[model samples]
Target: MPVLDLLDLPAACPPGTPWLGLDLGENTIGVAASDTSRMIASPLELIRKTKFTQDAERLIKLMNGRNVSALVIGLPMNMDGTEGPRAQSCRAFARNLDRIQPVNVAFWDERLSTSAVERFLIEDLDLSRKRRAGVVDRTAAAWILQGALDRVRDQATWV
Candidate 1:
């Protein structure tokens, strides 16, 4: 399937299946999974970046294992709301994933996601800098996924 907008993803899935969220950084791919009801998102794991084929294989394995029906990738949009090299990279990743896997793929604006997660870790959890670095990507993935899940849930409430 072609790459889709994140808002359009919930409409494309079967009723009960959950979506996978990804924060694809240069060094790692942070992963998150929503509940079957699509109401909550939780960090799953972090996959260290390897070759493209290897990363894709690992992602596919996780998708199958978790029964993910769609993917929501965090598009690293510029703070000024413009697409940049990072956003293009994310779009390319989503396009490649869509081509290699049978599941639908989409992108969510990820501006400030990492910063927000970092703030939560420091202020709320009082995590050390090293510990925050270790888990921030996956936590940011959860933040991105939670944003999408909240929108989906809000739409459900109106219907």
Candidate 2:
């Protein structure tokens, strides 16, 4: 399926199926998964960068294994609320993934996601830089996913 609006996800996806969240980076792909209730998002894995085909294959495999209904990909927008090269890259990746598989896809604004995760890791969790490095990406994925899930839930409540 083509990329759908975030609000359309609950309708597009099968009820009770999980949604996969992705934070793509230059060298790694952070992965998170929402619970079947779509109420909680948790860090799942960090995939090292590889060829696009390989990355998509791994993502598809993961989605299949977990019975995921859709993907919530983070679009790294600029602080000024503008699309940059990174956001463009994410869009392209989402398009490619959609073409490769039939799952629904949506992009969520991800400005400051990584920084927020970093701050929480250092200040709240008191994780050292070295330890943080190993988990930051996946944690950021959860952060992104949580934001989307919150919005989705809020929108549902209004209706």
Candidate 3:
């Protein structure tokens, strides 16, 4: 399947199928999934980054088991809204994943998603630094997914 824009997802994906969101980091791939109703996004788990084939297999397995209809991956854009090496890598990952799994994939602008989640963890949740490190990625994944869900659901701010 092609890599789609956020707005294109609703038409491409089957209704009531859950969407998977990923924060693909160098060391780990944080996972999130929406409920079948697509109302809320919740952090699922993290997959340790191994070989590309292994990672793809694991992700495909997750999609299959979870009935994920589409994917919303966090695109690591620079603060100035420029595409850097990390953004290139994210596109490459999406292309390779499409070849392997053939799922509808969308990229959501994820500038500062990690930092924002970290800040929330520190200031509001008051989590320890170490604990923050462990959950930050997945939390960011939820943040990204929730943003997409909000847009799809036509929430106030997304408009």
The CA lDDT of each predicted structure is 0.87, 0.94, 0.91
Candidate 3 or 2, higher TM-score: 2
Question: Cα deviation in Å at residue 57, candidate 3?
Answer: 1.2
* Highest-scoring model, TM-score: 2
Error of 1 at 5 (Å): 3.0
Worst 10 residues of 2 by lDDT: 94-103
Question: What is the TM-score (0 to 1) of candidate 3?
Answer: 0.94
The best candidate by lDDT is 2
Alpha carbon lDDT of residue 147, candidate 3?
92
lDDT: the better of candidates 1 and 3: 3
Q: What is candidate 1's lDDT per residue for 9-116, written digit by digit as tens?
A: 877888889888999899999999999998899998898998988999999999999888988889999888999998999878877776788688877889999999
All candidates: TM-score: 0.94, 0.97, 0.94
Angstrom error at residue 117, model 3:
0.4
